[model samples]
Target: MNIKEKYEMSKKEYEKWGLDVDKILEELSRVKISIHCWQGDDVTGFEKTQNALSGGIAATGNYPGKARNGEELRKDLDKALSLIPGKHKVNLHAIYAETDGEVVERDQLKPEHFKKWVDWAKKNGLGLDFNPTIFSHPKAADGLTLSSPNKEIRDFWIRHCMASRSIGEYFGRELGQTCLTNIWIPDGYKDVPSDRMGPRKRLKESLDEIFSQKIDKKYNLDCVESKVFGLGAEAYTVGSSEFYISYAARNNIMSLMDTGHYHPTEVVSDKLSAMLLFNDKVALHVSRPVRWDSDHVILFDDEIKELSKEIVRNNALGRVIIGLDFFDASINRIAAWTIGSRNMIKSLLSAMLTPNDKLKELQDTGNFTERLALMEEFKTYPMGDIWNYYCEKNNVPVAEKWLDNVKDYERTELSKRS
Candidate 1:
């Protein structure tokens, strides 16, 4: 049968379970998954620099057709967005600023540096998010920024972060949406530190200076991200999860949780509900981590499903800002974007289709057996049919059919990059 016919049958089946398929589809459609710009160019921004990726993060592989400039990156983004359904936003780092061939230091950046991006976002009906590029620079050669003990080095990063906030405000003002300006530093010690408090103190002071100039919350929101450890800085990290969560709580700002930033055994899904209780909002950098913070492409795994379920069950959809963060140059860049984004959407849809209320009722009443049975039964539900209908409604191809478009673009557009 056709998608519409199958959806009609699925709708009846879900209604028998007291679930509204229409409501699930409508809610899922409204979610805007902010696609990170770094994925398109494999985290290699347009900045004219010889510095390699520092700070615990690195994009592996030398895949051809990686965006070489802002124009090409945006072009790739447009192509990827066409195959993905939903009104989404684009996340940009400071290094992506188009300076028209002039050398503009990160600290010297202004809203003017990103006028082209704002214009492109406006033309595409997408909102924009911002991040301060604290790594991959000469200043960060020592594997420190913001938390750097050197006064001059600390001050330089502070200025850059402040400038990033201004640029974020400009994006929100121009695009008519609040731009999330997230700060994640790679400052840590490769070996055990003699004094851990010193770097944390310096990092806190740097943050205080950066947030000193307040922009209207209507146009811009601030967030700080934490990491347990990084590649070179394995022994100690200044911005640990405990540090930023407390800072964000006390300062009334948002905390960003990257899925890959924590230890392998710990999952962000378990922490979502608790965070929602204290903070007004939270942001997510969703990606799959193989061993550490490897930034692998997302898969439809158990963790992702649980994460989406927590967001949906807690009714934190509006309170949570979802964004994709991963770079895998080993495969087709456009396909990577499409696959990860589509899986993210699928996870959310799965969560929405779940009868959380009924399960909660059973659990609250101590009907453990029924709850377990119902949960297992849900696994066999017609989720694929509902998803196919969603894609059709969004004017995107159903199932693996979208791969055809990506292959065509690879041959016609990406192949000509050289």
Candidate 2:
């Protein structure tokens, strides 16, 4: 076929796909979106394993040293935050720096960097929150299961826990934000039947020791983000929703439910309900649920197309943070960030415009099939338009220039092909 014919044929195939650009725009309109830098950072040096160690240097998802210092980073963040919709502000999840990592910097909490973040937040009229995760020392990179029979490994784990708490205190004092930590121990049954109960006991003991320290009440209780499965035997935290929620509340802590971490067999709505009932702010990692790898990409609107309507019905809009958790070594970092941020914004917009009455009618009429079908309307919800809507509502500058830039680029590409 001629080049024109090939282009025509490709356009026909694209048309046959029936993807609604208008709907995509509408979905993008619904909510504001922000990204965690880790997923977007250049990882020139990343290490995944160190045998017999609990953890190694977490080099993945770290921002490259492109900027001179912390001030530059904060300034960049301020610019990003300013562009987002004023009515619905987006926050970033800090890098989940592990035990003995650079984030801990020689046991001297150099949180001037964090202070800079707060300054950026205030300068840009934004708020910040924390999602701290504990590290398993490289010495025990094999695992940090309380169930580990080795005393030395356990001691290392204890030291790590202390560090985490110390940092949490610093965060609370400096930022006036709760140290919203997500405790996911890389411990569970790896091979044969290890002492599963023993590990649970030890994990609790370590947690209790940290809480025992007289930190101010402003420091929120750590949210144990227990998963049904993970890296190894020590990785499995809470097995059931009831167990997970009850355990967190029982210990006077909150439970952060990861929407993607649940065993694929369970329904998303049930999990959403569990989070809605217990957690103050539902902090979830947005990622596509692939068969083998939970591809930490921005979750496609198609995946949560139906479940989101239910979430809207429950009115859990404010209590949500769109976390783009991914390992994007395969894609260009800038493109990955743009796509991930756009998709997350779109997913939220899909949820935001969902009619509460329509959702209620579905629930009230007991029409499960129809409820799922109704969600179809949200799939292509106009997102870019929503930015204007929020802008009008809040008297913020409409992103006309930004939108024009995107359209101009699209037109240029199309012209080139023509």
Model 2 over residues 261-379: C-alpha lDDT tens digits? Answer: 66776545566776677666665656555542255566446556545655555767656544555546454343454456555554555555555566568879999888777666544
| Model 1, runs deviating above 4 Å | none
lDDT (tens digit, per residue) of candidate 1 on 1-418? 8999999998787888788899889989899998999988877788765468777778889878888888889999999999998889999999999998888899999999999999999999999999999999989999989988799999999999999999999999999988999999988989999999999999998899999998989999999999999988999999999999989887889999999999999999999999998887989999999988899999999999999999999999999999999999999899999999999999999988889999999999999999999989988898999999999999988999999999999999898997
Query: What's every prediction's RMSD, in angstroms?
Result: 0.9, 9.3
| Model 1: how far residue 163 lies from native, Å | 0.3
Q: lDDT score of model 2? A: 0.49
lDDT of model 1 at position 89: 97
lDDT of each: 0.92, 0.49
Q: What is the Cα-based lDDT of residue 241 in candidate 1?
A: 98
What TM-score does model 2 achieve against the real structure? 0.67
